[model samples]
Target: MICKHRRYLMYISQNYSYAILRPIQKYILSQGGEVCWFLEGDEVDSSYLLTQETKLKTVKEVVDWKPDAVFVPGNTVPRFIPGVKVAVFHGFDSGKRSSKRGHFNIRGCFDLYCTQGPATTKPFQYLATKYGYFDVVETGWPTLDPLFEDNASNPYVDDNDKRPVILMCSTFSQSLSCAPTLFNKVKELSEKGRWRWLVQFHPKMPLEIVEKYKSLQNDNLQFIETDNVLPLLQMADVMLCDTSSVLIMFLLLGKPVVSFRNQSPSSYLIDVVDPSKIEGSIEKALTKPLEIESAINDYSKQVHPYQDGKSSARVVVATNELIENGLTNKRRKPLNLIRNFKLRKALKYWGC
Candidate 1:
């Protein structure tokens, strides 16, 4: 028979910390909470966030880990596990079958629900409530631990360089998805001799796209596809991106940015829990160009009010509470199994 309860089990919901959440994650570990990964190979840059510290054998690694509370962020299933849970709801896109493969492995998922904020998870909570009973909390953001780090005062990345670093945060613009176009854009910015561009792709993006970005081989351009997206902000002169959450993070850095309205199917931006007026409020910042900072200042304030560098700490506390409750209360069967099946099929399509 299975033990009614075990210790703490934390899994790798995503691969990297990039630069943003590293610090707060470090703080969480320091707080003496146990965390682990379903997969390994999260590269280490800063010591603040612990990576691969707890190695899990995936769902297949059942024997490898048995714990009282398990935290699943990033890629996960919503099965109703009797134990604790820390899950990040990706809003409607996740709620809707965002792909054709169908969902899978979401059974017995959360003892306590974790979302980006009250705003993002509110809709799901209503559904859960109507279904009868579900526990969800607006524990800030789970994956955004890196964004709240104290890299500098006012919680933003700034430098004294005349030529600023520009982060070209790209999304799946399949319509304009030709690698040559992205490469050319970087080359043009680099060749201008006035700016440096850092190209960071989403985890779901193809390696071939990243390879083409690397192939450009320009001195002024640095292209990276990694577990963490924080360093890109520190190195950014200005950010040009679509709807990635990293743009919200840039708000903490207090920099100017240009958001894209792409013509790609994948160009859709989720309702970022962190609000953005950056795209609209940007005034003559573009016209004057030299006034980028002021325009950046005016536009950036539109970010969601919750973007304090302390999000990771908030996450740790909320997750700990969920884990405690789950440990105390066991489930008779797995919950959210339907969602799991759909998600599994979807991951297979993505070759995950």
Candidate 2:
């Protein structure tokens, strides 16, 4: 039987994911649950602001913690650990093409999935039916909680400005990378001083590309290379992205977004094939942002309907239910036997 008193919840904190998991951590603590971090490294990234006292340095330490739930923001959770391994996704499921369907692949490492919304939840539910092991809970992403709560403030913007702010974010995938393609045009646009530009890219983006953008800095252009993109999203009047989950979050605000060479373009996206068309699309989007309000509203509902800022709370509840009820069937793992063997070998080699 599950413990009835205070519950212990641990999260596996990747170097780049602390920001994405912070909201769920905050919600768990507020509800009187014990929360701690499982640091894969000897030290947590200094940017996470977590004290050394709160981290479990190894997989053995995590198992010893006797956690009731293990929350993971990224795709995988360590196997053979006690507790309901919960996958709280790192970002929106943009449905971009990747090695294994990008954000759509179910790695089978999780016992329960606290999904972003219907767009993802529905598919996982079908998977749940097929697998007959895990459970899916339609909890809006905890990362977006602050945006809907109106508690998020933009430090980047600093003051109320007359110039319209434009945020340009792109995915790191080489197949869909737009930064290299649009940098020159964007630099020209920023030079015109018609709009304020904020350029943020995926953390995995190559350093050379990041350096190239950094070299073109001007009074109107600011290049931010931080893990947190929500604050930038809040401040921007218009957003330009391609095949990145950040665009979906931008659409949550019902703003216009232009995509370059989107493989599977959606009705809500302002699609343009050529980099030269970037300026015209941005102009059109900014001049009449409300023109596509209806489509944005529809997309937002499918992605995440709850704007009440209580998604983290819902996630906590769902986690508790899974732990208390317990899985009657054995938890599932990735179907590929070779991959599972390799994972086991790696785990043993690391002595985790």
Candidate 3:
């Protein structure tokens, strides 16, 4: 049971999502709130960067803790939990219409949403208006707080390596992915040794594609697969992307980005629609990364304006308000009962 003076907040981490939610966990502790973790996989244990006292391994342990609020970075939260479930979204709302995005379905699982900014809040607000379920709070993305902080540094960047570092990232979709399209071009470019290269991809990328890139790993080029890309964003001199939202987040650093077939290319992006032009674009981005700083700053304001590293604090406060108000704030029924029922069943099959 939650104490009258100090509330308890439970968070679930699935591999890399631990990176996104750790800041909120720290903030909750600072605010005199007790925190616990609900690990997504059996392989996860207390020894994995957390103490046994703070990590609850089983569903029964989570139930006994009786949290005042629960935060989920992924889409679904368990069916019947003690606390209010808050959907701390996993990725950017890139406006991509994919089956994975849950595009229009309000799953009725989350009591509240901690949105990134105005761009992300609009659609959720419209859903709240229509279904009268869930609250949308613009708390920025807590994971990004360190990026905007004065002391945040990337330990990976080597000053001795004179070559410009080029970072490549891609989404995992045929329609929007640049992975297949730019593979040969990137391999050819990396071979030249004109630049140091880093490759990161969406965790959902197909195994075949992953192996294809793994074969190309070499001395000047490295492949990274981690939940946290913020440090990578800090270290790289220039970024090459397709439609992934990380490109939008990278712009916050005021660095240059080259996009291949970005659906809605921003004025700040160095857009290269043709795969043939990627090599040339990377050279240009490396030459003058900050030339479009003014435009990138304007774009950053639209996504997340605050640089004070307090987004996690705002999310905690908003979540606590919902805890105090109780379930009266969330809609009991989903907008589409049949669809939500199916989704819930699928979630059960996955042990979510």
Candidate 4:
């Protein structure tokens, strides 16, 4: 008889996973579970950045394949496994005190909830706790597995580089606040010798936004967007990011990250949560973001708490446990919708 423990479905509908997901998904399958890709075909195709007809067509063909347990990128969708559905908060949620984002409400419907690592358990717990009633679990997010598998020598520096290299990542929308904040950080740091700034815009952001930065013409500045240029993250010593969840992978590299307390889609006030200061905070951090050496020494003790980097393994284990418990409980039933069909249904009804 087939082993019941070997049941999982890993789903990512966005382009963020094409490179990173392949190995992790393979590893999940190797561990006696199933992992697959199901792309959502971006909601809008204004530019042809998403046009890989061959690859898109391939994913569309296999979209219906299912598993006993499912994993989705965020609170956006629940991968409908025959037995369960799950929503994963795969990064440091930017739900600061000022901006209360209820995007995670989708978690109420999922059978399980997962986060990046132990460093995140408390912050995420707060989100679930605030609501008073919600079903949430703390399986470490799987995206960090690559760090464990990396046999490379330690690359993190003890002090800021002579010319600290900064990577600024902007989300598709609502980046106006983030851009100025990040630019201020970059401009402040660039005066130091050889300081380089590489700004990567989200694929869906406006071209005018990209053009504004490009015109700066600082010898140390370069602006790029959702291209095949994956090396930028690897080269960045510090990553300044908006609330985009993709920052998890950058942090996994042990690089320091400065997050902008993103404002509401309509609100005009810009607030910095973690640092609680404006450009001056960037001044202090560019000089000592995460206190490079201290963050390294106390990483296991304070921040990560569970820094084994086997987060993917934990996700698989927890998901399996959830499936087992769900099988025992009569109230919990599997989420039985197909991948694309869920998106279509959401668009037709919820219009998101």
Candidate 5:
């Protein structure tokens, strides 16, 4: 059984975590639970905290608050915090790196991992069996809850001018990024006015590249910079991307994606190596061939099968269940002294 008025902490290290965790925050608040924001690193902007939202400024405050659970969207969380540490994840597995370095990297920081779907759940379940330290729960992803909601508004709806809206996004990894390679081609297509274009980049995207795209904004193209990309994802008809996890979110919407040099090119994506073929690929995706559509549906189900917009609720329930059952049967969490020390030094929390 879950507590009715539980206290939760939103441990934020990166700005994008705001979009990832806010849906969960709303669900917590609606359940008569209290949520506090703990802004840890410089990547997070405190100004994003709303007036109604409470912000815990110091590690001492977080300790004193004694949250029932600390919801972490980033990779690691301070073990010193007085709560069950939960890993909600920041994004999908974009196959940008090896399993050891990327999504499946278990840092021994979390007690519960609320995975998106089977694609991640199966691997995490294997790790749970091997480690016996944490629990894996397929509660979908809170960030995607709004995507499936009924009342989500599309601000770009009126601007499409009957043209197929193409959202262009890329990863920040220098080796994997297609922004620089596809810039000239994207600019040329945007100028032709054949389709509407909306371009959003990773926050870590180089300043020069962001500026170049910003300068290209016109009647045909618009460059958006926001902590939340859900609106842009919903507004666009088709997405043109690289290996960015945002493409996975777009695919979950049952939309077709055209990628440039994706790390793992599958049937679901219309991936092209040559920049010249991007336009043709986008045209093909717009047509939505039966085979590609079927593949996208199959892939989406594996990545995130939930489309009810209730993932946040499931996450809350999963945390409660873990707390109620306790971790008595599991083995001790590895003493990750180095990572813990780094977290302690970063948060300046030396408490035992």
Candidate 6:
């Protein structure tokens, strides 16, 4: 399909959006399309913008550029922006919260939702039918393209160290996070120098907890703070996580995940209640037992079956299709006056 989306805008509000949108940007550039970024809010660092990348300093600049579509990794986008708003999503549904507040929450700011897989697509499709405003397309997730790409080098991988790498990730939510609970056990295990531990927490994780983990870094363990967690995910033999959606990302690699008190544990995860059992669970995951491996494969298929590094292409195509067809058949998006007003106040764009 010939993509008419020659000019696209990346709407970023958080640091993680950079990793999610960069692959899509790469695909657009290769297709001879132009992509510019419009960074909003304080959470997103302007320094993350590459020298080669173009940034529209103000909402006026974005309006003047007239992008065909605006790709948003966050929940909401400015509807006033002149483009078809596409929700690419920030992360998989980790089931940490109810559908009303979590991943399935529709704020009516998007024209289309490019879902990751069947698991998400079905629900979004149902919502589309019910709401009659936004369209749903299963284009996988562009953020994971690097994870599936061949010939990709992992800088974290050490040739000399043959020990299995365990990536530990946690959500930032005070109620759902396991970082605090597992800190003591992790510290004990890292000191043992049996397995290499890589600890990464959500950007919004509390400073005190993050510091505690950072202090535990030694020859056996490392605390990584990066925009891209793909390398760590690739290098790790097994993942140790809680309710963080990152475990879903790790599971897509067909690796085992040992979640600590997961909100909703299934056959896919070896869920442990006590911190003391973390090591045993890790060992079990490393073994890649037939039952758990089969479950992981099944869950991976439901969440993200696409192992090919071409989800970006599909996203571009989906956006182009939406732009060309228009939303004439669907009902208009809700006014969303309050949210839009807040966004306008934030961006200082009062233009009608």
Ordering by lDDT: 6, 5, 2, 3, 4, 1
* Residue 166 accuracy (lDDT) in model 4: 72
C-alpha lDDT of candidate 2 relative to the true structure? 0.78
**Cα lDDT of model 4 by residue, 1-352, tens digit:** 2223454544555554444344345556566555444455463232423342223233333334445655666455533224465565434444422323553443344665665445556655675555433345565555544444543443332255456677778765553347754554455555443556777776666777677777764666767654332466667776777666445456545655666775422111122554336445445555654355354445433323445656566666666666655522334333434644675565343321
* Tens digits of lDDT, candidate 6, 1-352: 4543479999999888999999999988888889999999889899988999999999999999999889999989988899999999999999988999999998989998999999999999899999999888899999999988753567797889999998999999998899999889999999999999899999999999999999998999999998888988889999999999999999998899999889998998999999889989888888899999899899889899998999999999888888878873379889999999999998999996
Task: Indicate the residue-level lDDT of 101 in model 3.
Answer: 45
Report lDDT (Cα) of residue 289, candidate 2: 53
* lDDT of the candidates, in the order given: 0.49, 0.78, 0.76, 0.52, 0.90, 0.91
Cα misplacement distance, residue 281 of candidate 3 (Å): 1.0
**Residue 306, candidate 6: C-alpha displacement in angstroms:** 0.8
65-93, model 3: which lDDT tens digit per residue?
77878888876666555687888777776
Q: Given candidate 1, what's the lDDT at residue 292?
A: 51
Clashes of each: 48, 0, 0, 2, 0, 0
Q: Which stretches of candidate 4 lie over 4 Å from their true place?
A: 1-7, 19-23, 43-64, 78-83, 96-100, 117-136, 148-163, 172-176, 180-193, 214-219, 226-234, 241-304, 325-352
Where does model 1 exceed 4 Å of error? 1-6, 17-25, 40-52, 58-64, 78-82, 89-108, 152-161, 173-182, 263-303, 323-352
How far off is residue 79 in model 3, in Å?
3.1
TM-score against truth, every candidate: 0.65, 0.90, 0.86, 0.63, 0.97, 0.98
Candidate with the greatest TM-score versus the true structure: 6
| Candidate 5 local lDDT, 1-352, one digit each (tens) | 4546789999998888899999999988887889999998787888878889899999999999999999999888887888999999989999999999999999989999999999999999999998899998999999999988754456767732988899999988899999999989999999999999999999999999999999999999999888889988888889999999999999998899999999999999999999989888888988989999999999988999999999999999989888788873379998888988988987788886
lDDT (C-alpha) at residue 107 in model 4:
35
Model 1 — which ten-residue stretch has the worst lDDT?
265-274
Instruction: State the local distance difference test value for candidate 1.
Output: 0.49
lDDT value, candidate 4, whole model: 0.52
Candidate 1 lands at a TM-score of: 0.65
Off by over 4 Å in 6: none
Name every residue pair that clashes in candidate 2.
none
Instruction: Name the top lDDT candidate.
Output: 6
lDDT winner, 1 or 6 = 6
